[model samples]
Target: MGGSTSASPCSSYQPSPSTVPFQRPPSRFKDINKNHVRLDLNSMVSTLVSDLGSVDINLKKQRSGLLKKHRDSQYRLVELQLVVRFPCFTMTGTPPSLFTMPPRRRANSVRCGKATQVSGETHRVTEKNGNDSLDICRVLNGMWQTSGGWDRIDRDDAVEAMLRYADAGLSTFDMADHYGPAEDLYGIFINRVRQERPPEYLEKVRGLTKWVPPPVKMTSSFVRDSVNVSRKRMDVASLDMLQFHWWDYANTGYLDALKHLTDLKEGKIKTVALTNFDTERLQIILENEIPVVSNQVQHSIVDMRSQQKMAELCQLTGVKLITYGTVMGGLLSEKFLDTNLNIPFAGPPLNTPSLQKYKRMVDAWGGWSLFQALLQTLKGIATKHGVSIATRCR
Candidate 1:
C-alpha cells in the first residue's frame, strides 16, 4: 500500500537455490530448540544422496535441478542431523552467504557454528526431502500490517525498516499479494540488497510471499499470470517461497492450482507452501501427490489447534509447520498483564486489527481473566530468565 508497481524497480537475476540435507526425526520432538540445531556435513552427504531416490519424485527432481545449478560452487553439503527436528526445517548444500557473516560486527547475531541468530534469538533451520528445501529464520516478519489500518507508511521508511531487520539477522520476511505495497517494498529492498549489501546478506534475506486467489478455474495460464505478477512486483527471477491460500474447498479448484504451482517450481519458485490450510485439506493435498513443503498456520500458546491434528500429519508426512500469531498479536506481552479492558475505558484499547483479532481469541480461550493469569505466569518465567515477555516470545 506504500509503493508503486507500474514497473519493476530492479532487474531480476537468477540466484542459485540452496538445499539442506536432512533425515526424518523422531516423532516425539514436540518443539524445536534453536540452540541445538547443527549440521553434520560428513554424514549428510551420503545419506541424503541415497535417500533422494526413495522420497517424493517431484521434490527429488526439484532438488536435483537446484543442485545441478550449484554444482560448480563451493557449497558444502551440510548435514542437519540434529536431535530435535521439524519436517520442513532441514538443509543440504549450505549457501555461502548464509553462514559467512563477519564475526566482529555480527558475533552476537550470526553463530555459524551451532545456530543462526535471528534478531538476538536463535531458531532451528532444517529441511526434509519431502518438504521445502529453502533455509529461513524461524521467526518471520509478517507484513500484514502493510495492508492497511496501521498508519501512513512511508515507502523509504518501510524499506529502511526492512533493511534494519535484515541487518539484525532477522532476514526472513513473510508477505502476501493482498498485503498492499508489501511486494513492492520487498522489490525495492531486495534491489538495495543486490546493489549495496554483500552477496551473503542477499542470500540471508528470504521474501516468502503468499498468493490468495479466488476460487476460479485454476488453469496454468491463470496461475502463471498470477505468479508472474508477484515476480514482477518483487523483481525476482524466482520467488524465494510462494505460500498459497484458497478461500473455498467446495470449489475443489485448489488442487488444480497446487498442481500448476508444483509445476512452476522448475525455475519460477524456490518453494511452494500453504497458508491457513487445515489438517484435512493438507492431507488431501498430500494424497493428491502435491509437493507442498510446509503449511503456514496460526499457531500460538493460546491457539494450539495446529499442534493437535496438523502437527500429527506434518510429523507423519514430513511437512513443516510455519507458525504465526505466536505472540497473540502482542496480547501475550506484559502490557496486558495487570489491566482490565472490560471496565469502561480502564485499559489499553484493542485498537489495531491484530490486537482485536487476537483479543477475541483470548476471550474464547477462557476470557481475559484466564489469559491474565497465563500472562502473569509467563511474566514470572521471563523475570526468572532475565528476559522480557516479548524476548521470550522471540
Candidate 2:
C-alpha cells in the first residue's frame, strides 16, 4: 500500500458499460454431462485436498498450544493473525492501485467513485451518484476473524479494524443475523465512523445483514420485526440492505416473508435482497415480483456452479452477486501451491457453517488432483498479472 504511483485516476481502461451485460456460461453450475461438471476451477488447492479434523486441528487449537510446547497447551490457532495465502502467485501486469466497479454502495465505505483494489484490477463501482455501490473486496474483512471462536474480542480493536478497512475504501460487508455479536459490532463500527470520519466518508461503507429464519408461514409482522431488530442492532434508522435466507424451499411461507420485506423496503427499512438462494428459488422470487437487488452465495472460481443459470438470472434481474469463499478460506495462496495438502484442517477459522459446508462443495466439484491443477493455472495467470495469488486471483 505504501508503493507510490502516479496520483491520478486511471484513464487507462474504462469498462464498456456494455460489459455490465457480461453473462456467464450456462451448464457451468449444475449441468450434468455424465456427472462431468468440471469447472476447471483455478485457485487454492490445499483447501480441497485434505482430510478434515487435522487440517483444522492446527488451525482450531487453543492459543496456548500455538505458542507453548506444553502437552496440555492448546494451540491458539484461532488467536494468531491468520492470513489467506496462495503459492506460485505473481501478478506484475496489474495497475498500481485498485478501483472496483460494483453496482451498489455500502454504508461504511462512504467513498463513492474512489479507486480501490486487492490485486490491482482497476474497477470503479461508485460513480458520482450516491445510489451506485462499489464491489466489496472479494476477500472481505471477516468479523469471524475476531469474534468467530474467541471467548471475547476487544471492541475497540475490532472497531479500529473496521475503520481501517473503511478508510481505505473497502466496503460491502457480508454478515448474518446469527453471527456472534456481529450486529452489535457493525453497529458500533458505523457509529464510530459517523463520529470520526468526515460526512462524505460516511457514505461509502455499505454493510449487508442477513435474516436466516426457519422457513415459516412468514407474516408481515414477523418480517418487520426481524428487520426492526437488525435496524436496532446495527444502530441505523434505515438498513442499507437486508438479505433473507430460507432453510426450507418447500414451504410457501417464504413468499409471505418477502412481501413484508418489500413493504419495509418501501418504508425505508432496507434495500431488499437474498442470500444463499439458488437459481431456481431466485427465478421463482422474481416471477412473483419480489424486488431483490442481490444474491449472496458460495461463489468462487473453484465453485463455478453459480455461473450456470444463477449468474444469468442475476444479469437479467439486475441483481449482482456478492461472492464469499472466493479464496477458499485462503487455500488458494502461495503457501500451498505445490505442497501436498494432506494435512488435517490446516486452514484458519472460517466462522459460518460455510467453511465446513463449502469444503464438501469442493469435493463434489472435483477431487484434489484436479483442484491442484487449477491452482497451477491460476498461479501462472497471477504471475503474469503481477499481484498476490490470493489477491490477484483468489
Candidate 3:
C-alpha cells in the first residue's frame, strides 16, 4: 500500500478460468480404492439436485454446529428492512482502494462491470497495537470450502486458484483450525506469493485464521502449543490474527483462552479476535480488557441480528465487525429469483452446505413467498443499477 506501481497488480494479470478437471491417479482405480468416490464441483451440484434427502441428512451433521447453535436466533422473526448498509466484499475479488470499513457511511450504490475506486477513502479494519497497526482487507476470501465435504481438492489446483485471487487484488484469506487443510493451503499459497510475485504483493496478503478448541483446560502451555501448531502449518513466523471460538460458553475456559491469546500477541500473535461471539460475551471480554480487535459474525440482509444489540457495543468499544453470509450462500443471486422450490425440478437445488444452511435461514426469516418478494425487490434494485442481484447483495 505504501509504494505506487505504474501497473496495478490486477492490471498485469487477467486470470483465465480453469476448465481443466482434476486428474486422479490410475492406481486409485484399483480394488483397494473401489469404494472411493471422487466428486468435482459440478457433480456435487448435480448430486444435491438428485438426492435432496441425503443432503438434508448431511446438513444435520455440519461441522460448524456451535456457530449454527449461536446464530439460530437469526431466523426467529423477520425484522423490517435494514436502513443502513455496512461494508462488504464479494467472494470473487475486491478493488485495491476498498479496504474493510470506510470512515463514512456511504450509500448502497452499485456500479456495473469493473470495480470503481473510492478515491481518498481509507477503508480498512485497523488492529491497533500502541503505534503499530494491521490494516485488513474489507472482504476476506473465506476458505471454509477447503475444509472438506464439498469435493476432492487437488493441492496444486487449489494453490493456483489462491494465486489468481491474490493477483486480482484479493489477498486477505480467512480460515480456521477445524477447517481441514485451510491453514496448510494458506501456507503453500503465501510461500508461492513470496517466491513468485512481487515483494509488495506479499505485504498486501493477509491470512487470518481461527482457533476453535473444545471446552478444555486453557493452560499457558496448551495455548502456546496450539498456536504454534497453526504457525507451523501456515509457515509463518507469527500469525497475522488468531480468532478464538468457544463451544460451551458456560465453561469459563473461553476467557482464559482469550487471556492467553492476549498474552501471546506480544510475540507469537499480532492481533487477537473472536468468531461468532454474541454481545453479552463480547462485553464481558471487553470488561476483562482482552483487547479483541474485531468480531467475525454472520451479518447479511437476511440476518440483521448483529446490527441490533452488537452494533451498539461494537460502536462504543471501537471494535469492528467482520461479517460472513453476506450473500446468503448464493441465494441472493439471480439463480433463485422468481424460481419455485416447491416443484420437483423448478428452482436451482440448495446443494452446497452454505446454501442448505442459508435456505433454512430464509425459511426462518419468512416463508418462501416472503423471500421471493425480498428477492424481487433486490432484483429490481440491481436491475435499476445495471448489476446482478448478487453484486447488489454484496
* Candidate number with greatest TM-score: 3
Task: Evaluate all candidate structures by whole-model CA lDDT and list the values in order.
Answer: 0.60, 0.51, 0.60
Ranking by lDDT: 1, 3, 2
Task: Report the CA-based lDDT of candidate 2 relative to the real structure.
Answer: 0.51
What's model 3's lDDT at 294? 75
- lDDT for each residue of candidate 1 in 1-394, tens digit (9 for 90 to 100): 1111111111111111112112211211123111111111110111111111112112232133222222345432222111111222222111101111121231222222222334433442543436458877755777877765566567899999889878877688888776667888899999999999998778778898988776678999999988998998899999988988876677899999999998999989988888777677888999999988777765454554554456557767777767666676678788888999889788888767668777876655446865665566566656765655544321
Candidate 3: 10-residue stretch with minimal lDDT: 43-52
Q: 315, model 2: CA deviation in Å?
A: 1.9
Total colliding residue pairs, candidate 3:
1
True lDDT of residue 30, candidate 3: 16
lDDT of 3 by residue, 1-394 (tens): 1111111011111111211122211211112111111111110000101000111122222212212212223211122232323332222222111213334454334332443341112323455533335777655788766655466667889899888777765567898775667788888888999899889778888989988775788999989988998998889999998988766667989999999888888789988888777777888888987788777766555554555556666766667667776777688878898998988889897666667667776665545766676667666666765677666323
Pitting candidate 1 against candidate 2, the one with the higher lDDT is: 1
